[model samples]
Target: MTLRSTLTTLAAATLLALLPHTAQAAEPYPDPRPITGQEIIHDPTVSRLKSGGYVAYSTGGIIGARLSEDGRHWTDAGNAFAEPPAWWYEYNDKADPWAPDLSRRDGRYWLYYSVSSWGSNHSAIGVATSRTGLPGTWTDHGKVFTSETTDTWNAIDPAIIRADGKLWMSFGSYWTGIRMVELNPKTGKAIPGAQVHHLATRPDAPYAVEGPYILKHGRHYYLFASYDACCQGVNSTYKIKVGRSTSVTGPYIDSTGKPMLEGGGDLVLEGHGRYIGTGGESVFRDRGKDVLAYHYYDAEDSGTPKLGLNTLRWTKDGWPVVL
Candidate 1:
């Protein structure tokens, strides 16, 4: 080769090395990985264990739970409660619980679960704590907050978050979207003087937003919620949506700059192919990345609800994407 050509090649290589390299963008909404062993769960929440295992709880009788030695393989850990709390029988006919939130704090596991009946606003959120977080060791703390028939919000799908030096819970369902309230850190119940704050809602009849799980990323508190009709098997139109705000109690807005109170949300995950009706999401940090966990109807498996997990990607503009 000519000396001039060799010099040109070296210069080009040096320039290429000096320029920053960027990885290829991940596929949007990449298919969730299959979870092995006893995987039926609705409105699931997962927490990483100190022993490097994972424990998950979901909506069911006595709050069904599963434990995983590795994040991939799971075994039935039984129910968080042996039987439903007696107070729950007043609201729900079957006395079954739904949408349990699991978290660990100060060397103990704190679980917040919702007890309510179908198509009714008479509901209550309850707390239970356990030293080991394993099945059956939890000591029930009874009802934390309850709603009467006159109330506009249904107190279900409890999620606890510690932000701004206080413990707060965000919960609600179809009646009036999602709501938040400050909680007594020591008792894990609502603070006496603090008032309930409204978050997101759809004004249309039979409002469809629910399952409020908040995750703080950088300067924003992102609210992840399920939208549309849930629980109809394959016919379910459920999907996941998100909004963010600088404050924990939000006037949460979407990427388009529309407030969530006006029915604005950025789509995170929805049905694709056999992964139908993807909703009931919770975000958990594993290793260094955020993992989005939920349940999807398996079109290939008789439309049964099963576990779904995916890595969450954030855009430079500060929005969450499932990848």
Candidate 2:
């Protein structure tokens, strides 16, 4: 590469960092090789452990765990939560953990995950409790939520957000739209008989929205979601979007006030270079910095989905720009 080309690339990056609304052009991020047992690591949900280090979780194929001392280079801890929990024998023929959301609350690390089956929405989201955010000592809370029928929208990809002094969960994608329900402060279970409020999507162009993560910055509540084809090798077109509302059970709308129920989204990151099908986002605020965690299939790595972490910054005018 020529020096001039390098200078051009650096200038472009600078411009992106300076601009807060539109995303910065995708560049080669920190690709720490020997990301130790991070094989096909997809559906990333990250949390900063109270005792320092970061716990990053993923689904399917071994159900792995990677610990990052500095929120970057990971030391593989092997499979943390494997499937075939005997619950699968009672339900689906196979057990696939969809997405796991990690949070520290009430002096314990609560890990909420799901179980899935192919060709059916007959699924369940489960929870596990850990005193230390490491492998071992995880107490299972089985079947947090499940589908009544195989055809109805399945409950998976759980993203728990605490708003208005209560915990809310957003779960669902195809078959039915995304909905939010309050969880009991003690057990983190949905308040009994509390009808979940519908949040986004319409009958037309449903787009199969899922992976909802909320970030409450300043006074606005931001709802970030992923839209379209996931899990399909290189043919996927998954992208992330965000909308905000004053209330947790929101009629979330885009920057233009267009309802997410109306199928409106502002794109944050998409496939670039050898990366394709970027989606499955998890957002959190840490140490005055907002972090976005998601997965992208790296063609350079033979379409293997690898975990990615990027810094998120907001505009003076209230737009979230990915750094």
Highest lDDT scorer: 1
Q: Model 2 Cα displacement at 157 (Å)? A: 0.7
> Looking at candidate 2, what is the lDDT of residue 175?
61
Compared with the true structure, the alpha-carbon lDDT of candidate 1 equals: 0.88
Off by over 4 Å in 1: 1-28
Q: Please, what are the lDDT tens digits per residue for candidate 2 over residues 37-136?
A: 4445788887887888788888764356878877757777766654446775444555656788888888998888877776456777778888997865
> Which candidate has the highest TM-score of all?
1
What local lDDT does model 1 show for residue 266? 79
Local distance difference test, per candidate? 0.88, 0.75
Clashing pairs in 1: none
Question: Candidate 1 clash total?
Answer: 0
Question: Residue 179 in model 1: shift from native, Å?
Answer: 0.5
